[model samples]
Target: MLKKSLLLFSAACASASAESVSVYFGNGCFFDQQHTMVTRFEKLLLKRSGSDVTSVSAYAGGDSSSSDLCYHNEGEVEDYGKLGHAEVVELFIPDDKSLKDAAKVFFEDFTQLAPGQWTRQDVFDLGPEYRALVGIPGGVSGPYYSAIVEANSEVHNLNLKEGQGGDDDTIDTGVVWVMDSLKFPAYQAEVCLQFSDDNPAFSEPYSEKYHSLRDALFEEGTLRNTTCPTNYIC
Candidate 1:
C-alpha cells in the first residue's frame, strides 16, 4: 500500500504551500541512535525547516503520564512501559520536509549494522518506545498528510518501510504509524539525557564519545540523581 520512491518529493515540494510545517517523529531509541539523525537532518534541512529542530527524547503512545511517572524501571504503577509510553524522539519540524526524509535518516541511516543496512537492529531495546512513528500537528490525515506523504512518495522506490523497519512490533505492517502528535503527547525524557556529550556526530563515522556522560547517567539512574565512581563526579 506504501510506495517507495523519493522522486515524488520534488513535485510535492513544488506544489506544497510556502507555509512552514512542524512535525514529530519516533522510530527508535533516542539515545545515540535516532538522536544522531536529528543533528544530521538539522544540518541539511534547517534552511527551510527552521533552525529549531530538536531530538526530543520522550515516552509516548501510551496511557497517561498522570497515571504514572517517567524515567523509572517498569513498576506496578509508576512505570513508563506499563503506561504504554514508547521511547520516541519528538522532532520539531517547522517545515514540511516530508516524512520520507525524516524516516530515511532516522531508520535507514545511523544504524549499528552500517549506514543503509536496513538490518532493523538499529536499537538496543524492543518496546512501544522503539516503535516507528510519524506525527503531524493535527493528525495523520487530510491534505497535510497527503501532501507530506506525496512528498514522501518521492522515495517510494527506496522502500522506507522495507523489512518493516526490521521490527515486527509496529502499529502497522512495516510502516511507521502516522498519528496526530497533539493527541499522543510525548513525555519528555530526563533532562540529563539531552545533556550533550559536546560531540557533533553520534554514529560510526561521527564522534565516538556521544554516550560518555549520558552513559554515565544511565548507570547512575534517576534524573541527575546518581552517584558516580570515585574517579568521576556525579
Candidate 2:
C-alpha cells in the first residue's frame, strides 16, 4: 500500500490573480494491469491543467480509510468491495482561469470520448480547442502534450503493449467534481453523473485496466449532481 503523503497543493492561490484547483475522478475500476492507464491519466491531467498538476490515487466514497489516501492497484484488497474509488488531482491556473472554469474544461475535454469510438488521436486533434484553456497559448509546440518529459515518456510507453484495445471494454464509470479554495473556506460543490442502463459508470476498483477505461468513458457523459450518496464519500 502506498503511504499517504501531505495532500498536494498548488502554488497558485485562488485569489484575484491566480487560482488553486483540484478535481477528484471517481468510480472506475482501476486495476494492477492498468498502471499505464493511471500514468497516462496523470500525464493528460498535467498537460490540460498545466505543467504542475499533482495527481494521486485514493479510496474515496466509503472505505474505512477513505479520508486517507489509499494505494490504487490490484493488490489492495480493501478497494475491491468499496463503494467507489477516486483520483485527487491539483492544478494551478495563473491569472486567466478560475477553478470552476478549469473544472468545466476537464469535463468538456473528457466527455468527448464519452460516446462512440474515440482514440488518443482524437484527444490530440482537439489541441486547438484546448490550447487557450490548457495549453501555453501562442507558444509554438511540436506536440500539444509535449510540456513534460515524463508525460511524453508515458505516452511513448503506451505503445509498448500491443493488441490492447481502447476504453470500450470497461464497466460503469463517472466522476464527481468538487472544488475547495482557501480563499473561500465555505465553498464546496459536488458534480456527479446519474447512472442508467446505457451509461452506468461510477467509480470502483477494477481487476484490469481495460475494464476501468470503459467505465471511465461512461462517466464522462453522465449528468452532474450536487449530492453524493451515503455509500459515496465525495
Candidate 3:
C-alpha cells in the first residue's frame, strides 16, 4: 500500500509538471497607490486563471522625474532612465487549454475595466510601455494597447534574448506596467511578467513603453483622481 501511494504521488507530480505554463509581468517605477492597483490586477488574473495555474511573478521599478534632456546641436536628448526599481509576477498554467482560458479571462476583465474606446486587441498591442502611458493627462502619443496585443500574440512562438533589438521579427513579449498615487503620502508600484527571468539590459530601455502609456492614460483623464507624490515632483 505504501509503495502504491508513493507511485500515485509521483504520477500526480508528473501530471502537474506537464500542464504548467509560465507568465511574467513588469511594473516600472511607481508609487504606493500604483502598486496597490497592480496587486489588484494580479489577484484578478489569478482568479481568472483558476486552480490549474502553477506559479506567478511580478517586477516593479521606475523614476520620479522625467529624464528628458536638451542638446544644443543634436536632437532633443530624452534620457528616460529607470530608478532600477522593478517587481515581478509569474503564473503557471496547467495546459494549453488553461493558458487559452486564462488569456480569455484576462481580455474580458481588462476590457470591462478599461474605457470603451479600447479593445483586447488594442491593449495586447500596446505592450507594457503603452499600457503605462495610457490615461495620462498630458503625455506623448503612440500605439499603446495595440502594441501589447501584438507582443502577447507572438510571445509563445519566440526565443527572447535578455537585451537584443534584432528580434523585432519575433514578438517582443516583454512588458512593464507603471502606476502612481499621491494619497496617504504613499508611493508604490508593482511589476508583472509573463516570462521567467529579469534582464535589466532589455528591460531598462523598455521603460519608455511605460512612459508612453502613462502619457496617454493621463491625457484621457484616467489618472486625474490620483495625485502625484510631492517627493517625486513629477
lDDT of 2 by residue, 1-234 (tens): 122122322122322133333323222222221222233443343342222223222223222233232232344433313323232222333322332233333333233244532222122222111111111211123121223223323332111111111112111122121211121011011222111111123224433443343344224421122223322432
The alpha-carbon RMSD values of the candidates against the true structure, listed in the order shown, are 10.8, 16.7, 18.2
Q: Once superposed on the true structure, which residue ranges of model 3 sit more than 4 Å away at CA?
A: 1-15, 25-53, 60-88, 111-116, 119-234
Query: Which tens-of-lDDT digit does each residue in 38-103 have in candidate 1?
Result: 456754755322223344455555535342235543233345565666666554444444454665
Off by over 4 Å in 2: 1-21, 26-51, 57-59, 66-77, 80-83, 87-96, 110-234
Across 45-151, the per-residue lDDT of candidate 3 in tens digits comes to: 44422222222222222332222111111322321122222332333444545444443333332222233222222333222222221111111122223333444
Q: Residue 91 in model 3: shift from native, Å? A: 1.2
lDDT of 1: 0.45
What ranking emerges by TM-score with the best candidate at the front?
Answer: 1, 2, 3
Q: How accurate is candidate 2 locally (lDDT)?
A: 0.26
Q: How far is candidate 3 from the true structure (C-alpha RMSD, Å)?
A: 18.2
